[model samples]
Target: MKEKITYQDAGVDVKTGYEAVKKMKKYVEATKTPGVLSELGSFGGLFQLDLKGYKQPILVSGTDGVGTKLKIAFMMEKHNTVGIDLVAMCANDVLCQGARPLFFLDYIGTGKLDSNQAAQIVEGVAKGCKEANCALIGGETAEMPGFYEKGEYDLAGFCVGIVDKDQIITGKDIQPGDVLMGLPSSGLHSNGFSLVRKLFFEKEKIKVEQYLKELGDTLGNILLTPTRIYVKVILDLLERFSIKGLAHITGGGFIENIPRILPEGCRAYIDTDSFPIPSIFTLIEQLGRLEKKDLYHTFNMGIGMIIVVDPKEVDPITKFLENKGEEVYEIGKVGRGEKGVEL
Candidate 1:
């Protein structure tokens, strides 16, 4: 028989993946909060939910992945911020229901794990958890030599949150005349990179490292920028007021995610002129030839987290987030319509 080269022989590394887990344990522990019951290597994450503070306690869970945006991270070889993206993708979703994240777990699978690369990934996850005030309880790192091409990896995150049953914000209270407020986004938060890649690399004929004033970095760097985690800011406001709805702008942007939280007869009309969208979106739209509609449907367009509140509460909510250094804007208003978002 001719000599055979196995999958491992094709440069898929195994031990390196486990080593990455070992390397990131410290940073993971740094993000631990009150609910964590087990350490990183456990088969299952353990969390204890305390109901002492409320008459009825409810558990909330959300799961999400980094999508093809990982391709951008891979192309750029920048692995630090996506962990935050993974955390935000899930934690922010739970926040939409007005829950406080209690703990988070993640799954990372790769063709081969370079200890250094895996460490960077978990380090990012841990950093995100700490920023959102959730416990980094546990996670898994899988090394399947044949499953992925060498140097390719994927991330999926799971999170659990807690809220008093009566306090959950499910948009049930939304009505006409409720104000729509916007919190600006840092950049593209883990979605639409497939289109972004096509625009910058395939269509625009640009290199990843080419600098642009709008992005303030190489194309790859801008694409790899981390998703912003809005858990802390909104959770803070949850304590002081009753919010009608919360929408975390993600893959569907305002056009889709916003509608999910709107009541059956209520719709959101966003004012495109309200907030100053970052230069990156303008650059992409002008250079990539993307339509204004598709741009709002695909990307956050600089507004990441949207807070919908009753008209009476708008001033307090605005002043509260503003005091916290948030750039808040009166972006739109809720009105009676078929369930949808309008610009």
Candidate 2:
């Protein structure tokens, strides 16, 4: 008799994937935000967006993924924190336009469904949505057996936000002489990890749990610290400060992100000495013999979000973020002629 072959034999069991969602439905409902109408297991997830208030409301949406940082999570056997990274990646971009995050969705693809491990990630997503003042409306988890190696997974997120047309933040309002306030990051915050992993694992041969003084924890512990959510904090600061623009420092770090907010004929003159470089960044530099320019261009190096504001609002804006237990710095001043960020 001929042997029978099936998708299950290749390891792509649709039933297992459906079962994973069944397990997550209860946990997901607990994080339900108001407008979420339908339950999981349906042909398509339903989300009702209600904008009962505001004149000239504009919808802002952003999609992003956690990048190869997932590899570290797999190696460390830590899956949860990356969920926050997923939300933060998308939410921060939407917030940059001064949009208030309204809802979030995530896509998690894995080789196989590990209910317990996957739930940990979903829980962190719920937590992140709350932190960003958004609803965990819905998400998708696919068990694509042949696509990924066993124990490997990938994460991506989508965020929807709203902002009044008049209140939208664009670099056009950001003129030369505007002050740039930098918000300190939680550490790395989901960028440049491919370089980090290469440096530590391949070059230095350091284990995830190995403790280093600068990072103040095992390598895995520090790197796993969830990305910081700047939405809630910046939303509140908008009232007191004429926030001309915002820059979320991620992959390209200062070199790329800061330039995004500069108006034509204007540049950012950053005072490198303005803020003390965090110990963790310093540690990476020393260990890797990383060049100064590479450090700033590759990692947050300190700043996570750069707030471009009128010079007049600097004092109060600094006080506001500082009061929230955030370390805010006057990293630079907007200047003309350079057309980009100058350190």
Candidate 3:
């Protein structure tokens, strides 16, 4: 008799996938709010937009992945923090347009699903959604046996938000005499990890668990630090301040991201010494022998989100943010120049 074929034999376990989803339900329920109308296992996530306060409600959506930082997560066998990075990458982007994040969805694909690991990863995502005050409506967990290595996986996130048409903070209004206020990052905030892996794992052969005096933390812990979610803080500032432009510093670093929100004939003159950079960056620079330009172009360099406001509002805004338990930095000012960032 011919051997019977099964989905499990092909490396896909419907049972395990269902179990993983089952494990994620509690985390999903933790992010529920008034607008969430769909349950965790629904065919589609339903979020009834609550626009009672807005004259013109505009939807803002952003999608992003953790990028090569997932590699670090895999290397350390730490699946938790990368999910937070996934949500942070998307949530922060939508907030740039002055939107209040409403709901979020996630995607996780792996060669073979480990129910426990998948649950841990989704736990992080739910935590991040809670931090952003967004609902974790629904998401996908795919187990494709041959696509990814047995122990490897990839993650991504999508976030939707709503903003009033009149309140959109496009960079068009950014002009000279505007102050650039920076919110400190928790750490790397999930970018530029390809180079990081090359330096630490490929070239130096440093073990992920190795402890360093300068870092005061294990290499794995520092590298796996969860990305910061700025939705609550930024939303609070929006209510009280006239923010001209907002920039979520991600992969492009200062050189690339700052220019995105600069209007024509406007330039960002950044003072490198305006704030203290986390020691992780300095250690990377010293160990990798990377140049200053490369460092600023690749990583957050300790500054995660940049807020542009009128110069006169700088003191009050800084004080407001500081009072809210945020580390605020007057990193730079908008100037009339060639429409680029100058460090």
Candidate 4:
């Protein structure tokens, strides 16, 4: 008789998947908020909206993945922090709309399931959810044989947030003479990695373990720093300040993102010297011989989040943010011109 085949033989292991779910359960539970109605294994996540103070509640949703930055995580063999990047990418986008993140779900696709590694990744997701004041209600782990390479996986996240209709920051109020304040970035914050990898690995042929004086750490460590989640601070600011517009500096950087919140007749004038650019960006520019416009067009260049506010309120807002230990900079101002950013 011919030997019987099993799902394991086909490269999908049900038992291993069960083990991974088992290992990740605690991390998932730790992120539970009052609104989360379903457990981690539920078919769909359930969040009870507390509409106590909201007259017209609006739901804001965002989804994103950690692009080629995953390559750096793969090189470092560290799986913990990438999940945080996955959550931050989605949460920060939702935050730009002035929403309070309620819950988050993550998806992991890989050739094989490693329970320990999967658990590590989920731990980071839970940590990020806690920081963002959201719940990690549900997620999926797909094991597809021959789909992804060995020891490699892809991650994506979905975030849902709530905002009152009147409280939604639509950037419609952004006008000429608005002061633009910036929140400093914690390194690259998970964008422009394709260019970064080419410069460091392909062109310069530098190893991840190599230490540089400028960065003050190993390339892998610096590159693998997780994206920052500004949800908590921004939410607090919303309550006490008259924030006109918010821009989460992501893939497009200053040139593309800043214009997103600009009004029709308003343009953004950024003083390049207003905030100090991180050394890693300077290194990339020097190594790649890139132009100023191209660098600002691609990476955050140092500022992660920009706040557009009434010029009169700048002093109070700056004081409030600084007391919270944020490295705030009065980076620029909105001016009367075409709808774009000028550096």
| TM-scores for all predictions | 0.94, 0.95, 0.98, 0.98
lDDT tens per residue, model 4, 68-166 = 998888888899999899899999999998999999999999999888889999999999999899999999999999998888899999999999999
Question: lDDT of model 4 at residue 214?
Answer: 89
Better of 1 and 4 by TM-score: 4
TM-score of 3: 0.98
Off by over 4 Å in 1: 1-14
Q: After superposing candidate 3, which stretches have Cα over 4 Å from the reference?
A: none
Question: Candidate 4, TM-score vs. the true structure?
Answer: 0.98
Steric clash pairs (candidate 3): none
What pairs collide in candidate 2?
none
Taking the tens digit of each residue's C-alpha lDDT, what string does model 3 give over 77-185?
8887787888999999999999999999999989999998999999999999999999999999988878997788899889999999999999898888889999999
Better of 1 and 3 by TM-score: 3
Candidate 1 lDDT, tens digit per residue, 8-27?
Answer: 68755556656777798988
Error of 2 at 61 (Å): 0.9
Candidate 2 wrong stretches, greater than 4 Å: 1-3
